[model samples]
Structure formats: C-alpha cells, structure tokens
Target: MPEKIIVAGVPVDTRHFIGGRRVASPDTFDDVSPIDGQVLGPIARGGPAEAEAAIAAAREAFPAWAATPRAERARILHAVADGVEKRIEELSAVETHDNGALLRSHRRGVMPRVAHNFRFFADWLLTLGHDDFETRGHTNHVSWDPAGPCVLITPWNAPLMLATWKVAPALAAGNTVVLKPAEWSPLTASLLADIATEAGLPAGVLNVVQGYGAEIGDALTSHPDVRRISFTGSVPTATRIAASAAANLTPLSLELGGKSPLLVFADADLDLAVDLAVEQYDNAGQVCLAATRILVEESVAEEFTRRFEEKASALVQGDPREEATDLGPTIHTRQLEKIDGFVQRALAAGARAVIGGHRRDGQYYAPTLLTDVAQDSEIVQEEVFGPVLTLQTFADEEEAVRLANDTRFGLAATLATGDRERADRVTARLIAGTVWVNCFFVRDLQAPFGGSRLSGVGREGGTWSFDFYCDLKNTVTAPNGWNNHG
Candidate 1:
C-alpha cells in the first residue's frame, strides 16, 4: 500500500504555497518516487512573482528577527527540533515517497541529524562571538553580524538535513530566509516553514517558496533585496547563482558536488576499510562527499575487491519504505539518465563493472560497483551522484595519494588504516576540505564543513558558516588620544 503524507497541515495538491498562502498556478509538475514512477503528488510550479513575494516577506521580517537576541532565536530553533520530532515518522514516509531516501536511514541518519542541526546551531546562537585579541601595545578585535535576508537553495539529496544546515544557522544568526527547494522535493521544505510557524516564528522570518529554479531561484538571486545567497547544488547551477548574485554584490557560500575518494592501504584494517568505503557510497551513493572513487593498495587489491564486491552486492535494493531496503533510487527521471550516461562513459573509457551497473525504469539505478577504473575516466574525475562506486588500484603511498588528488573535486575523503603514521601522512596529502580517518561521513554541526577546489567556496556548519552569512561590524574603542576637547 502506498503511504499518504501531508505537508504544512494540508494534503498534497498541484497547488503550492506562495508567501504562506495556498496559491494555484497553471504550471504544475509531478512529484514522483524515484524508487518507482509512482506519483506521490503533482506539485505546482512557482515563478518569479512567487519568488519576489517570498523575498519581500523575508525582507519585511529581517529587521526584527535579526534584532532578536540569540537566546530568542535559539528558543525558536529548539522548538523546531521539538516540532520535527512529532512528525518524524510522517517525514520519513514522505522522504521515501518524494526523494526515495531510505526510510530506515531517515529514521536513523537524516531525521536525528536534522533535529541536531537546529539544536547545534541553537547552542552556537546562545554563545555567539568573534575572535578578538588584546596586546600590550594596542587592542584588536574581529566580529560578525548578520548579512541580512538570504536565499538558500538545497538539493533533493538529504533535503531536510542539508537544508537545516543552511537554514538553522542562517536563522540562528538573525538573517531571514527565502528558501527555494529542489523541484523534486519541495514538500519537506514547505513542512519546515510550517513547523517554524507552529513554533511561533514570526511571519516571514523563514519563508519557503516552491518553484522551478529557472524562475524562482533566478529571481531570488537577482533580487536587489536579497543580501546573501547560500546554495547546495550542482556546480553549473551554483556558478550561475554566484554570477547573478555578483551583479548585485550579494555575498554567497556554496557546497557543490564531489567525486570524493577513499584511500585504503594494505596496512589498513580490511574489515573497517570495506565498511567505511561502503558507508561512503551508501544512500545509493547519492551523496555529495560519497566515495565514488575507491583507491586501494595494489597488494590488497584482489582480496579487497572480492570482499567489497560481495559486501556491495549484499546491499538491499528495493522500495525505500521497506526496512530491509539498504539503497533507494536517485532523485527522479532526470538523474537516472545523467547517472546512466556517466556509467556508459566509464565503461567506454575502459573501466570494468565488477558488480551491479544498470537502471530499472528511469529512477532506480542499481547499486553499482566498478573496478579497474582508470584515474583519467569521468567516473574518477567527476561527481557521479548515484549508487555507482568505481574502484582503482594504487601501487603504493605515492600512487594512493596521486589517485585521491586526481579528481577536480575536493569536498571530503576517508582514509582507512590502523597505522597512525600512515593516517597522518595521507591526511596531510588529501586535498579535500574535510578528512575522515578510519570513518566516513561523520559530521558534527558544531564543526566547519565544506570543500576546496571545484567542490565549493566557503564553509557550512559551525561559526564558519555564519561568518559567510554575516559581516563584521567593527566597534572600535575610540580612545581619547589626549586633548580631543581643546
């Protein structure tokens, strides 16, 4: 039986909310489950007008929200955590239907993290500060303040959690938001806005506008009123948003896709390494920092490949709502083709598919694992953003390092080893913004998270994210240097 879900206390329809009002537009799009082509709902398309309304609403609410003390902001955020808990099961079900994120993962991984994001930022908000210094000769201090109302665009992958990473901190820092969710999964974002409202957040403080990025996103980015734009999406789209925002001088932060590599040495714990690599490529490998490229030592290459292929094959592939399902489908029809193209390119470039490498319909790309993948292949160089895991063997420490850094992306990487020395050495050589030793995807909202190189600019989570969302308003202690009042 298909599970029915609701958003914002209202059932799904082609109609979408524009500025907290139920508005119907002739433009409508289907919300299909990636697991299959099941239509959960047909969502309405929002255009520039809706985007402008959302911006206006956020702008109207910005002053008071920004003026509110950190504690008050924290209070609201805390309430959001509480509110989300109430609907956790419903949210999980919707996630399975909308984006095809595994329900069990939603229960275990996504929801708790989403809740923690608010609570984490809430804690940070309660103790906001900037680094300062006092010397014998003079005093120097640096601080930050909210940038203003912002435009945040999040991807379909990890929608609620990643969106919270942007929205939680932005809201906690006193900046209002005009959030444009991915077309594939706007329901959750709508629910978040409703949850905030239910939590007593002032109207327009955290506005959600549902629409196509072409219409809504462009308007929000190009709007004169929007002060900052924080986005998590494709490199192409992010570049466009960055360029458009540059026209108005609105500061921006981004977290783009990744072809993150996992380096496993012969000296590494085989069990742990295999597990970490699998974990990195989990979520049907639909993660930004997923270990799409696996680099292992030539010594353990044969054995590791055997073990990994067996383990990777064991991953359950079926309906996301089922507890037994380990992997779900990609976001929608578009990505199915995109991921398929990448797979064909990899095969054409001489990489061998050691395990699963196919798609069912246009949604569920099989949990794939490719081996003997050349470093120069697209699978190694670009972000596949699917359940595909491509493996390449490395000769030694130098070769391992070389293979890991070969990609254009520098989002994150996982290094597995029992040897602390090797771990330290690899950690130094790894090019990513975040390095995980013996683990994968261990994220804490209190810490800075982002990427280097083409992966992205600036950071998210921790105070580092707020730094981008704000500017330092210096309050120099202007000392009277003798006889000002002559």
Candidate 2:
C-alpha cells in the first residue's frame, strides 16, 4: 500500500501557502478523488481577499528578489529542482490521487520532467546575456529585467507540470509569482510551494492561492501590483482573463484550448502512425496538444483505423493508483458528461464508432475512436478533450494540409512520414506553433512553445519564456552629448 502524503503535516485537504505560512480559510470545499469518487478532504476555499493578499505578498518580495544576482537565482532554482526530486514519490502520489493521473505516468513521465523544467531554466538563466551595440557613437546595452509580481494560472490537466512551465521561468528571470492551480487539482502545486520554501526561497516570493477561478481569478488578474499574467486553460476562461488583464493593460501570455491534429501520409510507416494514435489516449486525452483530429491518407485509412482500434481497445481503465492502468477517469463527472455529449452528437450526425464510444461509471469514458465524422462536425471542429479521437481521410498532400488547418485552433500539429521533403513541405504550411514530423509530443527546452491563433497569445518556453516574465530595457551611454546634425 502507498503511504498517504503528509502535506505540511496534514494528510490531505491542504491549505494555501501564503507568505511562507500555511493559512486556513473559514469556507472550504470537499476535494473528491476522481480516481474512485472518494472524498480526499476539505481544501481551503478562498475569494478576492485571499487573492489580494497573495498578490500583495508577491509584490512586496519582488524588488529584493529581482535585485538578487543571476548566479544566486540559478543556485536557488537548482535547489528547488533537487528538493522536488527528493520528494518525488510523496508528491507523485498526492498528484495522482488528486488529479486522476495514473501513478505510473507520474512516476515515469510527469514528475521527473517537472524537476527537469526547473533545472533546465536554472542553467539557461546562467547563459542569458545582455546585447550590446554601438549606435551613432553611443554604446547601447539591452537587458531583460524582471516584470515584477505576476499571476500564473494553470489548468487541472497535468497540473504540476504545466504550473512548472510558468513558475520555473518566472522565478528564473527574477520575478516573484503567485500561482493559482486549478481548484480541482491543488495538492501537488501546494506541495511545490512547500518545497520552494524548504529549498530557501524568500518568504512571499512564491505563493500558492487555492480557490475557484470564479471567485479569485479576476482579482489576481486585475490586481494593480500584478505586472504580467500567464494562464493555461479553456478559451472561454482565457477571454475573461484577457478582459480583466486589459483593464490594467497588463501583459499576458495565454495558452488557451487546442484542437490539434495528427497527420499520417499513406507512404509513412503505418505501424508508427498507429502507435502514435494509440498514445494520444494517454492522460485520458485531456491534453492541450493531444491528437484530437487524426488526418490520414485515404489509401491507408481503413488499415490504420483497424490497427488503432485494436490498440485503443486494449487500453485498461481502472483506478489511477494502480500501476497497470492505462486510462483513467475524466477529472470530474461534468467533464465525462461533456465528452459523452460530443460523441452522441457525432453519432447522430452519422459518424460511427470504431470501438469504445460511451461514458462508463461516473467519470470513466472509454477510449473511443470515430470515423465518417464530417470535417465541420462539432467533434472535429471543437475540442472534446476526452479519450475520444475522430478520424478523417485526406486524398492528397494539399487536401491534408488544408484539412489540418481548417480549425480555428493552431496550437500543435503532428505529421508522421518517412520522407524529409514531405515533412518540410507540410510543416511550413501548418498553422500551429509547434509542428512535429514523424513524432508526437517531443519537446525541447530551448524552443519557443505556444499557439498561433485562438490557441494562445504568446510563447512560453526557452528564452521566450524568460523574456515574457521580464521587461527588456535598452540603455545608451556616451562621454558627452553629441549632436549628429551639428
């Protein structure tokens, strides 16, 4: 049996970490485990007041922390990475229990990557250099400075990892941040706050506020002290945040919803295509970059569907804590019902399910694959965000590119092909920000990652991330005032 994670000496229902201290709230909400519908405990329920306090703390800590040397910031962030690594199992178990992510996935995939994100940014910051040039006999120096207190709002899916995507670079760039993890999955994020403090972060530099977005989200965005905001979630929420942030003219990085596609040409390795399609069902298909729409060459469409169905059908759905479970429940009952509605509407529109197509139990939706879905169908056009994939066939390369770019989303697109020429050709035309050839979900720390269209506003990885959390200032110096006209 796995031991329960002791967060701040409490077994569950963790409190918000504010100003480096655990704070309780008068109002609380029950955090039910999506794994088995069991009540984990009561999590702190906060509102505008809590959001204000968190922003105030971050605001206070920004100047001194920002003034800290680059070498020291790197050292502290490296320590944070080490701290997270040391508490892997404890944190992993907590995340899996709270978010319904399989324990194995957390152990082998997500948690390790979370630690690496911190370490990667830590090293990258050391190499961040100022640009210097001479213009009109004056030496000009450009440097990226901390953007001050910022708000980082992450979604429920892949909670800790996504939070790290925003948090690591913000801190690395010497900005203080208040992170609001999705109310549904706050356990690991709170644990990260504790780890940061234990790793020697200054009090109030990194704070975690736990509450529903409706109550506290706008407060964080609209707070006068918050200089920038980074959010990853649905398109609707992103619009709302954008409106609020605009009130202050706050700079924002929004990673909104995605209806990303996976393209497989006829000449491509059929085996690899099938494998990648099956892999899409991981994380219950709740990924922002998930292969929601599969575009395959008409020649191999039938065979590809047959093999994919077999593999997807073999995926086991059970308790997320179990090591062998492949697919887990949706984050909540509402998500499951939403997924079911998409499938039912598709079926009514004459699409046929190749395999498991319906919702099971309370929140478990089987890995479902649908065929004959119209290009404009709701399931094809919008993001279902479940373990459901819709298949469409394209006649030629031109049609494939056209069909792939048909949606409003332009977050991620994957193409599986053996030919490099074809890969280069299709990659350039795809509207998505990230295009993978012969692969899916392969990420590099140095690359700029985000969406192009309704998917997101700005990039959030590599130097782009460091740039986003900071304001660039250019200074020019000369021995005396020299007028070119004179």
TM-score of each: 0.93, 0.96
Candidate 1: regions farther than 4 A off: 1-20, 131-142, 480-486
The superposed Cα distance between candidate 1 and the true structure at residue 344, in angstroms, equals: 2.3
Lowest lDDT block of 10, candidate 1: 1-10
On lDDT, the leading prediction is 2
lDDT at 81, model 2:
92
Q: Rate the local accuracy (lDDT) of all candidates.
A: 0.81, 0.89
User: For residues 206-236, what per-residue lDDT tens digits would candidate 2 score against the true structure?
Assistant: 9998889889888899888899999999999
Angstrom error at residue 156, model 2: 0.8
What lDDT tens digits, residue by residue, belong to model 1 across residues 1-486?
A: 122245324454345444555556567676777766777666767788778778888888888888898888899899999999887877777776778888898888789888888998899877777666655545566666888888899999888988898999888888988887888887788778778878988888887777788877888899999988889988999889988898899887889988888888999999889888778556777888887788888899888988888888788777788888887778877788898999888788777888877887557777788876766767778777888888888888998898788878899888888899888888998899899998877777768888899899888778787787787675554344766676
Q: Superpose all Cα atoms of candidate 1 onto the true structure and report the RMSD in Å to 1 decimal.
A: 3.1
Identify the candidate with maximal TM-score: 2
